[model samples]
Target: MSVHSLNRLIELREREVERLNVEVANKRAVGDRYRRSLERMTALCEGSGASAALPPALSLNCGNYKQAMLGMVDLHRQDLALHEADMAVSQRALDAAARKQEVFQQLLARRQAQLLREHESREQKRQDELATQVWWRGQR
Candidate 1:
C-alpha cells in the first residue's frame, strides 16, 4: 500500500481508539454512580442514629420507599450489566485496533527503509556525476 494511504489509515485508527477510550470511561462513570447510589440508600436506611436504626422520615414512606428502593436496586443491576457488556465489547475493539496499529507501524517502517535506500542511491549517482565533472575540468 502507498505511504499516504497507510498514514491516513493510521490516523483513523488512532481516532477510533481514542473515541473508544472515552466511551469506556463514560460507561464506567455511569456504573460507579449507580453503585454509589445503591450504597447510599443502604446506608441511609440503616441510619447512623445509635438507638433509632431507621431515619425518622424513613418510616413515613415505608411501603412506597421499600418498593422504590427495590426498583432502584434492580435498575442499578441492569445498568451495571449493560456497562459491563459495553466495556467488554469496547475492550475487544480497542485490542483489535491496537493490533492494526502495530501492523501499520511495521508497514511504515518498511516503507521508510525502502525510501531511505532509494535516497541513498540517488545521492550516490549525484556524487559520481560531480566527481566526473571535476576530473574532466582538471584534464581541460
Candidate 2:
C-alpha cells in the first residue's frame, strides 16, 4: 500500500486499540468493584456470629438476619461469576485489538523502510549517471 494509505490504516488501528484499552479498563474497574462487594459480604457474614452478645430482644432476629445474609451472599456470588465472565471476554477482546495494532505497526515500518531503500537506489543511479557523463566529457 502507499505510505499515505498505510498511515491512515495505522491511525485507525491506533484508535481502535485505544478504545479497546478504555473498555478493558472499565471492565476491570467493574470486576474490582464486584470482588470488593463479595469480600464485604463475606466479612459481614463472619462478623454476624459475634453479634450473639446483643440483648434478648435484639437477638430474636438472628435467624432472619442469617437467612437474609445468606441470600445476599448468594446474590453476590452470582454477580461475581457474571462479572468474571465479562472480564474474560473483555480481556480477550483487548488482546486481539493489541495484536492487530502490532501487525499494522510492523507493516507500516516495513513499508517505510522499503520506501527509503527505493529512494536511496534512485539517488545512487542518478549519481552514477552524472559520473559517467563527466567521464565522457573528460575523454572528449
Which 10-residue span in candidate 2 carries the lowest summed lDDT?
A: 50-59
TM-score of each: 0.71, 0.87
Model 2, range 70-105, lDDT digits (tens) per residue? 799898889878878887888888798888878888
lDDT of each: 0.80, 0.84
- List where candidate 1 sits over 4 angstroms from the true fold: 48-64, 125-140
Model 1: clashing residue pairs?
A: none
Question: Which candidate achieves the best lDDT against the true structure?
Answer: 2
Model 1: per-residue lDDT, tens digit, 53-99?
Answer: 55666645664666676677778778778878888898898889878
- Model 2 lDDT vs. the true structure? 0.84
Please report how far candidate 1 places residue 125 from its true position, in Å. Answer: 4.2
Pairs of residues clashing in candidate 2? none
